[model samples]
Target: LAKTTQPISMDSYEGQEVNITCSHNNIATNDYITWYQQFPSQGPRFIIQGYKTKVTNEVASLFIPADRKSSTLSLPRVSLSDTAVYYCLVGDGTPSSNTGKLIFGQGTTLQVKP
Candidate 1:
């Protein structure tokens, strides 16, 4: 299983772009990197996913390097409401790790200040 490492906390101001990076040292070639956002008292919601290169959506953009060992989740023009705990996951669409079907990290807490 792939293991991820990320910062414990991050601080950002309103209207700022926040990029959270996650490192997966043991990532397999067939594994896909995904990011999820979670608010207090709520389950995590999918933010983005990528295998290689760049992928953008209405909410965020995912950037993966050629090595496929790390990825970045970029949130544009974030507001105070965007503050949440973000989790990085590695999986292959099957029950692989303790996270049922994915391997989830401890998560990174983001604080958006006004």
Candidate 2:
């Protein structure tokens, strides 16, 4: 598994955009970069996933560099409700390759203030 490093914490104000970057220097060719958001006492929720380039969903956007060595999770117009821990996971997340194995490191804590 490729090791990922992220900021320990970030502060943002309501209606601001937040971009949290994760570094995975040893990423593999078949690995996919996925981001998750977890609130207090709740399971991690999928934010976005991508292999290369950019992917956007209703909630957030994920950008993976060509080297596949890093990714960024972008949240637009964040609010107090968006304050949570954001996790960056790198693995074979394809449906056919899903192994139900996920190693989560200490995630980035996002603090959204009013």
Question: Which candidate leads the pack in TM-score?
Answer: 2
lDDT of each: 0.90, 0.91
| Candidate 1: regions farther than 4 A off | 93-100
lDDT of 2 by residue, 10-31 (tens): 9999999999999999887778
How does residue 16 of candidate 1 score in lDDT?
95
Clashes of each: 0, 0
What is the TM-score of candidate 1? 0.92
lDDT score at residue 59, model 1, on the 0-100 scale: 98
lDDT of 1 by residue, 42-96 (tens): 9899988888999999999999999988899999999999999999998774444
Which parts of model 2 have CA positions greater than 4 angstroms off? Answer: 93-100
Residue 67 of model 2: what lDDT? 85
